[model samples]
Target: MQYLKRYLLICIAFICILLGIIGIVLPLLPTTPFFILALACFARSSQRFHQQLLNSPYVGPILADWEADKRIDKQRKKQIMLMIVCSFAVSIWLLQAQFHLQLLLIVIMFILLFCIKRIAEK
Candidate 1:
Protein backbone atom coordinates (compact mmCIF):
# COMPACT_ATOMS: atom_id res chain seq x y z
CA MET A 1 0.00 0.00 0.00
CA GLN A 2 2.77 2.45 0.84
CA TYR A 3 4.64 1.53 -2.30
CA LEU A 4 1.52 2.02 -4.38
CA LYS A 5 0.96 5.47 -2.89
CA ARG A 6 4.56 6.44 -3.59
CA TYR A 7 4.28 5.26 -7.18
CA LEU A 8 1.09 7.24 -7.69
CA LEU A 9 2.67 10.35 -6.20
CA ILE A 10 5.70 10.00 -8.46
CA CYS A 11 3.48 9.66 -11.51
CA ILE A 12 1.43 12.71 -10.58
CA ALA A 13 4.60 14.68 -9.88
CA PHE A 14 6.05 13.79 -13.28
CA ILE A 15 2.84 14.80 -14.99
CA CYS A 16 2.71 18.11 -13.13
CA ILE A 17 6.37 18.84 -13.97
CA LEU A 18 5.62 18.16 -17.62
CA LEU A 19 2.61 20.48 -17.51
CA GLY A 20 4.73 23.16 -15.83
CA ILE A 21 7.27 22.90 -18.64
CA ILE A 22 4.49 23.21 -21.19
CA GLY A 23 3.03 26.16 -19.32
CA ILE A 24 6.31 27.96 -19.86
CA VAL A 25 5.53 28.18 -23.59
CA LEU A 26 1.75 28.48 -23.23
CA PRO A 27 0.81 31.82 -21.79
CA LEU A 28 -2.72 30.74 -20.92
CA LEU A 29 -1.51 27.91 -18.70
CA PRO A 30 0.14 29.31 -15.61
CA THR A 31 3.23 27.39 -14.43
CA THR A 32 3.80 28.22 -10.77
CA PRO A 33 0.92 26.29 -9.28
CA PHE A 34 1.75 23.19 -11.28
CA PHE A 35 5.40 23.43 -10.34
CA ILE A 36 4.46 23.85 -6.70
CA LEU A 37 2.34 20.71 -6.87
CA ALA A 38 5.14 18.83 -8.55
CA LEU A 39 7.52 19.90 -5.84
CA ALA A 40 5.15 18.70 -3.15
CA CYS A 41 4.66 15.33 -4.79
CA PHE A 42 8.35 14.87 -5.50
CA ALA A 43 9.25 15.75 -1.92
CA ARG A 44 6.97 13.00 -0.70
CA SER A 45 7.79 10.34 -3.27
CA SER A 46 11.30 10.75 -4.68
CA GLN A 47 14.33 12.62 -3.41
CA ARG A 48 16.05 12.43 -6.80
CA PHE A 49 13.11 14.04 -8.51
CA HIS A 50 12.86 16.69 -5.82
CA GLN A 51 16.56 17.55 -6.18
CA GLN A 52 16.25 17.72 -9.95
CA LEU A 53 13.26 20.03 -9.63
CA LEU A 54 15.15 22.27 -7.24
CA ASN A 55 18.06 22.37 -9.68
CA SER A 56 15.86 23.56 -12.53
CA PRO A 57 16.90 27.09 -13.44
CA TYR A 58 13.45 28.33 -14.34
CA VAL A 59 11.59 27.05 -11.29
CA GLY A 60 14.26 26.39 -8.66
CA PRO A 61 14.48 29.82 -7.08
CA ILE A 62 10.75 30.23 -6.71
CA LEU A 63 10.46 26.80 -5.12
CA ALA A 64 13.39 27.45 -2.81
CA ASP A 65 12.00 30.78 -1.64
CA TRP A 66 8.54 29.37 -1.17
CA GLU A 67 9.90 26.44 0.81
CA ALA A 68 12.07 28.61 2.99
CA ASP A 69 9.66 31.46 3.71
CA LYS A 70 6.25 30.52 2.40
CA ARG A 71 6.30 33.80 0.58
CA ILE A 72 6.66 35.13 -2.94
CA ASP A 73 8.55 38.32 -3.78
CA LYS A 74 6.62 41.53 -4.44
CA GLN A 75 7.69 41.67 -8.06
CA ARG A 76 6.50 38.14 -8.70
CA LYS A 77 3.23 38.87 -6.98
CA LYS A 78 2.65 41.89 -9.20
CA GLN A 79 3.49 39.92 -12.31
CA ILE A 80 1.12 37.14 -11.32
CA MET A 81 -1.64 39.65 -10.58
CA LEU A 82 -1.18 41.29 -13.96
CA MET A 83 -1.30 37.95 -15.72
CA ILE A 84 -4.43 36.95 -13.85
CA VAL A 85 -6.15 40.24 -14.61
CA CYS A 86 -5.32 40.13 -18.30
CA SER A 87 -6.41 36.53 -18.65
CA PHE A 88 -9.67 37.17 -16.83
CA ALA A 89 -10.36 40.29 -18.84
CA VAL A 90 -9.78 38.43 -22.09
CA SER A 91 -12.06 35.59 -21.01
CA ILE A 92 -14.81 37.96 -19.94
CA TRP A 93 -14.62 39.94 -23.15
CA LEU A 94 -14.68 36.84 -25.32
CA LEU A 95 -17.63 35.19 -23.60
CA GLN A 96 -21.17 36.24 -24.51
CA ALA A 97 -22.27 36.60 -20.94
CA GLN A 98 -25.02 38.79 -19.51
CA PHE A 99 -24.08 42.27 -18.31
CA HIS A 100 -24.75 41.41 -14.68
CA LEU A 101 -22.59 38.29 -14.92
CA GLN A 102 -19.78 40.27 -16.44
CA LEU A 103 -20.04 42.88 -13.75
CA LEU A 104 -20.00 40.17 -11.09
CA LEU A 105 -16.88 38.64 -12.56
CA ILE A 106 -15.17 42.02 -12.68
CA VAL A 107 -16.10 42.63 -9.08
CA ILE A 108 -14.73 39.27 -8.03
CA MET A 109 -11.54 39.91 -9.95
CA PHE A 110 -11.17 43.29 -8.29
CA ILE A 111 -11.56 41.69 -4.88
CA LEU A 112 -8.97 39.08 -5.70
CA LEU A 113 -6.57 41.68 -7.01
CA PHE A 114 -6.99 43.75 -3.90
CA CYS A 115 -6.32 40.76 -1.69
CA ILE A 116 -3.25 39.79 -3.66
CA LYS A 117 -1.95 43.32 -3.55
CA ARG A 118 -2.38 43.44 0.20
CA ILE A 119 -0.48 40.19 0.61
CA ALA A 120 2.28 41.41 -1.62
CA GLU A 121 2.65 44.57 0.39
CA LYS A 122 3.36 42.57 3.49
Candidate 2:
Protein backbone atom coordinates (compact mmCIF):
# COMPACT_ATOMS: atom_id res chain seq x y z
CA MET A 1 0.00 0.00 0.00
CA GLN A 2 2.79 2.40 0.87
CA TYR A 3 4.59 1.61 -2.35
CA LEU A 4 1.42 2.16 -4.31
CA LYS A 5 0.86 5.56 -2.77
CA ARG A 6 4.44 6.57 -3.48
CA TYR A 7 4.16 5.46 -7.07
CA LEU A 8 0.92 7.37 -7.48
CA LEU A 9 2.55 10.49 -6.13
CA ILE A 10 5.43 10.11 -8.55
CA CYS A 11 3.01 9.72 -11.41
CA ILE A 12 1.08 12.81 -10.39
CA ALA A 13 4.26 14.84 -10.05
CA PHE A 14 5.46 13.73 -13.46
CA ILE A 15 2.14 14.68 -15.02
CA CYS A 16 2.20 18.07 -13.37
CA ILE A 17 5.75 18.70 -14.53
CA LEU A 18 4.72 17.86 -18.07
CA LEU A 19 1.74 20.20 -17.82
CA GLY A 20 4.04 22.90 -16.48
CA ILE A 21 6.32 22.48 -19.43
CA ILE A 22 3.37 22.77 -21.78
CA GLY A 23 2.09 25.82 -19.95
CA ILE A 24 5.37 27.57 -20.67
CA VAL A 25 4.51 27.82 -24.35
CA LEU A 26 0.73 27.94 -24.19
CA PRO A 27 -0.51 31.35 -23.11
CA LEU A 28 -3.73 30.04 -21.59
CA LEU A 29 -2.15 27.27 -19.47
CA PRO A 30 -0.24 29.30 -16.81
CA THR A 31 3.01 27.44 -16.02
CA THR A 32 3.79 28.55 -12.47
CA PRO A 33 0.84 26.88 -10.80
CA PHE A 34 1.54 23.52 -12.43
CA PHE A 35 5.22 23.76 -11.52
CA ILE A 36 4.28 24.57 -7.96
CA LEU A 37 1.86 21.65 -7.89
CA ALA A 38 4.62 19.33 -9.06
CA LEU A 39 6.93 20.72 -6.42
CA ALA A 40 4.43 20.04 -3.69
CA CYS A 41 3.76 16.53 -4.93
CA PHE A 42 7.46 15.66 -5.25
CA ALA A 43 8.26 17.11 -1.85
CA ARG A 44 6.00 14.50 -0.31
CA SER A 45 7.09 11.57 -2.49
CA SER A 46 10.80 11.87 -3.29
CA GLN A 47 13.59 14.04 -1.95
CA ARG A 48 15.64 13.69 -5.13
CA PHE A 49 12.74 14.79 -7.29
CA HIS A 50 12.19 17.80 -5.06
CA GLN A 51 15.84 18.82 -5.38
CA GLN A 52 15.75 18.44 -9.15
CA LEU A 53 12.62 20.58 -9.36
CA LEU A 54 14.26 23.29 -7.28
CA ASN A 55 17.26 23.26 -9.57
CA SER A 56 15.22 23.62 -12.76
CA PRO A 57 16.09 26.83 -14.60
CA TYR A 58 12.68 28.04 -15.69
CA VAL A 59 10.44 27.32 -12.72
CA GLY A 60 12.93 26.91 -9.89
CA PRO A 61 13.28 30.56 -8.91
CA ILE A 62 9.52 30.97 -8.89
CA LEU A 63 9.08 27.96 -6.63
CA ALA A 64 11.88 29.17 -4.34
CA ASP A 65 10.43 32.67 -4.08
CA TRP A 66 6.93 31.33 -3.51
CA GLU A 67 8.10 28.93 -0.83
CA ALA A 68 10.42 31.33 0.97
CA ASP A 69 8.69 34.66 0.65
CA LYS A 70 5.21 33.92 -0.76
CA ARG A 71 5.92 36.64 -3.27
CA ILE A 72 6.57 37.23 -6.95
CA ASP A 73 8.39 39.98 -8.79
CA LYS A 74 6.27 43.08 -9.47
CA GLN A 75 6.93 42.96 -13.20
CA ARG A 76 5.74 39.40 -13.40
CA LYS A 77 2.58 40.28 -11.56
CA LYS A 78 1.86 43.06 -14.01
CA GLN A 79 2.39 40.81 -16.95
CA ILE A 80 0.08 38.21 -15.52
CA MET A 81 -2.60 40.74 -14.75
CA LEU A 82 -2.41 42.15 -18.24
CA MET A 83 -2.70 38.77 -19.84
CA ILE A 84 -5.67 37.85 -17.65
CA VAL A 85 -7.46 41.08 -18.38
CA CYS A 86 -6.88 40.71 -22.08
CA SER A 87 -8.17 37.17 -22.06
CA PHE A 88 -11.22 38.33 -20.21
CA ALA A 89 -11.66 41.09 -22.71
CA VAL A 90 -11.62 38.62 -25.57
CA SER A 91 -14.06 36.31 -23.83
CA ILE A 92 -16.44 39.08 -22.96
CA TRP A 93 -16.30 40.39 -26.48
CA LEU A 94 -17.19 37.02 -27.91
CA LEU A 95 -20.03 36.49 -25.46
CA GLN A 96 -21.68 39.77 -26.26
CA ALA A 97 -24.93 38.06 -27.13
CA GLN A 98 -25.33 36.85 -23.58
CA PHE A 99 -25.83 39.61 -21.07
CA HIS A 100 -25.78 37.19 -18.15
CA LEU A 101 -22.52 35.73 -19.32
CA GLN A 102 -21.02 39.21 -19.53
CA LEU A 103 -22.10 39.92 -15.99
CA LEU A 104 -20.61 36.62 -14.85
CA LEU A 105 -17.36 37.41 -16.55
CA ILE A 106 -17.24 40.80 -14.86
CA VAL A 107 -17.68 39.14 -11.46
CA ILE A 108 -15.03 36.57 -12.25
CA MET A 109 -12.65 39.30 -13.36
CA PHE A 110 -13.10 41.14 -10.06
CA ILE A 111 -12.56 37.96 -8.08
CA LEU A 112 -9.38 37.18 -9.99
CA LEU A 113 -8.18 40.74 -9.44
CA PHE A 114 -8.76 40.36 -5.71
CA CYS A 115 -6.92 37.10 -5.60
CA ILE A 116 -4.00 38.54 -7.53
CA LYS A 117 -3.81 41.45 -5.13
CA ARG A 118 -3.52 39.07 -2.21
CA ILE A 119 -0.26 37.69 -3.54
CA ALA A 120 2.61 39.73 -2.14
CA GLU A 121 4.90 41.51 -4.58
CA LYS A 122 8.65 41.06 -4.26
lDDT of 1 by residue, 1-122 (tens): 99999999999998998898886665445678788899999999999999898888878988888767768898889887887788768766866557886777778778767766665332
Q: Give the number of the best model, judged by TM-score.
A: 2
- The clash tally of candidate 1 reads 0
Question: For every model in order, what is the number of clashing pairs?
Answer: 0, 0
TM-score of each model, in listed order = 0.71, 0.72
List where candidate 2 sits over 4 angstroms from the true fold.
14-31, 55-57
TM-score of 2: 0.72
lDDT of 2: 0.82
The C-alpha lDDT values of all candidates are 0.80, 0.82
Model 2, 3-53: lDDT tens per residue? Answer: 898889989999988887886555445567788888888888998999899
Candidate 2 Cα deviation (angstroms), residue 34: 3.3
